[model samples]
Target: MLRSRVAAAGGCVAALGLAAALAAGAPASATDRTDPNDRYTAEEIHHFLEGFYGNHGPRPWEREHLVSDRLKERIAQTPGYDLLLCAQNEPRDIEVGEVTTAQSARVGWATITTHWSQSPRTAAFTAYVDLDGSRPLQLLDVDCAPGD
Candidate 1:
């Protein structure tokens, strides 16, 4: 009888162990996982823009990897001014505002404010970002704020 009881307890322990292992290996809930289609969240857009504007070394057009083909064409046509900041010269500091989703799920827009150290004036522009699933995030276009 004692041996049978010991065998039963061992069986129970083994079953419990198997259950725990299966539970541990189970996939996370749908909500916990990110959707591949919505990979580029608003926060990601803000970060990308912040990084792009923060680096003043390269011209917006020069960073072909970051700019879309359409934007590159626009830049080529419109010369002299920096299309990204919509300013003639690079700013001392760039403040990228909250990024919001546009009409399309794959597009986002943010207000980029450029501050110059030498002048009290500041320039603001609307930066359109393309969050293409097939490719990395790229700058779609830059529209200067009214009255420069």
Candidate 2:
């Protein structure tokens, strides 16, 4: 169960555009493309979060980007911290409310609303997606926060 959740969370991180952030050191693949929709799946969000909390690692989502070399060093020092903190634990439940898309010749953006659930508690968040949907769906970025 834990393994499945961790894999799901990793997949979610990859889906959430964090893969690009994490893959900063990886070589580019010929098959790699930047389309937000292709990269993000509504269902994947739930799985990712599930894995995040399940593992008890540091959270990339907790701090936005890896930032400077210092932060990267911190991240590296704490192996699997991000994955364990963010993917292994469950945050109650998630409700993807509505999704809206905006586009131009060069790029595109999507706004999605989601709800989070935990025993005796519930919260909401919104995600903003920017990527090249015309070619393939890849996450550019996301903004999320608690909602009422």
Candidate 3:
């Protein structure tokens, strides 16, 4: 009877441990993008921007999906500089700052800080993101500011 009780206790402890592990490993609610109808959370927007700036070389076509058609047209019209990075040369590293929801329910803004290896200066930009319902989150525009 003692052996059976000990075995049962061990199983209970193992089950509790598994449950805790699963909970810890689970993705946050804000990061879940399964439903398109739901408004994009600040965390989601931050994650998207991080992935965008983290990539090397020229921006990929797939990454453009997150940008609106209007913004794409504007980018094409502009020449000599990268509107996204707001610089002629790509930075060695990028740091995406806090994302906050704007006055509009479907809009949010994030600060993107760029660090260059060749220069001591760092640039910052405010990225405007649109979270229209039933559609994937899209970047509307970026407010570029001079480097410090």
Candidate 4:
């Protein structure tokens, strides 16, 4: 699926000085995990997806580390694409666009399209979160591309 693959090669490093250049460079209190208001917001989803798709690291307050091992391995073996000025350079600045949520007997999730890269590259994600408020947000799936 597109979502799963989004976590794949987006994390690779490149040739020449590009790799080193790309290698360069938050939070609230809460044991209130049980609090009803402690639901997963787009902020949390974007933070998680940032790591999953952009090859970025996890943000603070994230409960689990979710980078896929296969993705990591692929990134290591393949040359990373350095063309994403917005995606690779200032990934954190990328914003979450539209967000919608749903649940089934099996799972609950939020479907989102993020402003991800610059003018073109964008991402769609289905991130699952615990509505019962016992756990933190997780990316059930994610897909990214260069245009609409």
Top of the candidates by TM-score: 3
**Candidate 2 lDDT, tens digit per residue, 74-112?**
546666443212222344343344444444423233223
The segments of candidate 2 whose C-alpha lies over 4 angstroms from its true place after superposition are: 1-88, 104-118
Q: List the candidate 1 regions with Cα displacement exceeding 4 Å.
A: 1-36, 55-62, 103-105
Writing each residue's lDDT as its tens digit, candidate 3 over 13-126 gives 999987997888965453356334567777878887787677332276634776778878888977998887788887888888999975356788888888877678777888
Task: Write the number of the candidate with greater lDDT, choosing between 2 and 4.
Answer: 4
TM-score of 1: 0.67
Residue 15 Cα positional deviation in candidate 1, in Å, after optimal superposition:
26
Give the distance in Å from residue 18's predicted Cα in candidate 3 to where it truly belongs. 11
Error of 1 at 77 (Å): 1.2
Q: How would the candidate models be sorted by TM-score, starting from the highest?
A: 3, 1, 4, 2
Give the CA lDDT, 0 to 100, for residue 8 in model 1: 100
TM-score of 2: 0.32
Output the worst ten-in-a-row residue range by lDDT, candidate 3. Answer: 27-36
Q: What stretches of model 3 exceed 4 Å from their correct place?
A: 1-37, 55-58, 103-105, 146-148
